[model samples]
Target: MNLQDSAIVQQFQQHCSLTEEEKVLLLELEQNPLKVNAGDIIWQENSKVDQFCTISQGWAYSFRNLGDGSRQILKVYLPGDIIGMRDFAFSNRLAGVAMIEEGIVSHFSHEHLLKIFRHSTALTAGLFAIACRQQAVLTERLIYLARRTAQQRLAHFLYEMYLRLGRIGAADEGRFRLPLSQEQLGDILGLSAVHVSRTFTAFREDGLVLRDRHRVTLPDPEALAQLAEFDGGYLNDAVPALFFDREWQSHMLAGPTARSDEQMPGKSKAASAD
Candidate 1:
């Protein structure tokens, strides 16, 4: 696969209209690619963090081990995701990343990324928008684990994956290949493997999804979305036009000081209405 034509770049292009010159500059920043096999650790918690990578193909996940020795999956990384961007402000990796399937990732030094930031306003804005979307996904996962029922969490998770994969042109007719095991799903959704299996059975019995090993088919996306109480607003693809406004740009440059309080899943206005 062409690294330049990867889904991550396509997604970035959607948010920022890059000039030919800018595209060349961005391409130069990426070094040789690395091949990761299934179960390989891409980065480990507390490791030195000097570079970020873009997933050119396959899937991976970021997770952390709790004090009790159980793992909490932070987020699932689909093809085209920028891994390690979430920990840009930190000196070391805050979480561990591991490949779920054979994949390719291209690394870009943090120094080179900073150089790009200094020279390109549009690219910087695009990167910021991508970071915000990553944060949104994490927020949604927090909500899923804390307040949503097992069924709701599973439904919402699958629906989100479907939309994400669709954005990358990886899914068709609501069908996609997800290589995660039941144990991994349990880590992500805070359930036991047995519970995850039972939930999958429930979803299948309800006619929401059809499962064939690693392949999943959502027969009725609309019905599934309703069941999950999913709102796609959190997955907005375009950056706000107002971000280009001078005053707004200045405000963003000043940086955010405080983060929003964690949101309860069913407490949001949209969720309450459902």
Candidate 2:
């Protein structure tokens, strides 16, 4: 997929008002989107950071290596998700993000990004919104880890993925590929690997979901929602709490060139929104 045509970049434009000059600069960077394979480390924890990366296809996860030699999966980033935006402050990597499947990513220098913000209020606000959204995701995840049960945690994770996949038009009406392993799942959900497997087996037996290796099918949507206590309130596009600015919203829906209804089910689309 061409990075320039990726929905994430389009969303970024809407969120961070890109001027013609900034667009031109991004176009140059987008022309050479990087391809990465599963298991490849995109960045290492504590590594010096220079470029910001936005996921265009497939999925990635960020994690920290614990002193006990265990890795904790912190966040899963899908298409349209940008990582390391927080590191723009310190300009250094504090953790690592690795691809979970084959994917495309675009990287931009920190200096150029700062330049865009320096010259444009709209761009600055858009970037701020993106930062806020990331913070929101992180906060919600923290709450899930601290307060939710194992079953509820798993359910909530699935529901979040479902909504995100639907947004990018990459999901089957209620199902999609799960690009994670049992161990990775355990890390993200704060459960043991064995516990993750057992919980998944229970989900399968209950007929709420079906799983085979890296694929997951949500067979009963309502049941799954109830299990997760998913109100969809956390994903409200119209909610100002997610950090969308009015100007960015206006620019996105202002023209036909704005967001398009993503094609779904069996059609191959770039993984930007997931």
Instruction: Assess each prediction's global lDDT (C-alpha) against the native.
Output: 0.80, 0.74
Best-performing candidate as measured by lDDT: 1
Work out the TM-score per prediction: 0.85, 0.81
Quick one: best TM-score, which candidate? Answer: 1
lDDT of 2 by residue, 1-274 (tens): 5546765657666465455665565554455589999888999989998888888787999899999877888888888777778788775688898999899888878876777666655656666776776777678778878988888889888878887787777788677888788888899988899998889889888888788877788987778879877766556544242233334334444454534563322223321232
Tell me the RMSD of model 1 versus the true structure: 8.2
lDDT of 1 by residue, 51-123 (tens): 8888877899999999997898988988777888877889999999999999888888878789879877777
Clashes (N, CA, C under 3 Å) per candidate? 0, 4
Model 2 stretches with alpha carbons more than 4 Å out? 1-4, 13-31, 239-274
Q: After superposition, how far is residue 161 of candidate 2 from its true place, in Å?
A: 0.6
Q: How far is 66's C-alpha from truth in model 1 (Å)?
A: 1.3
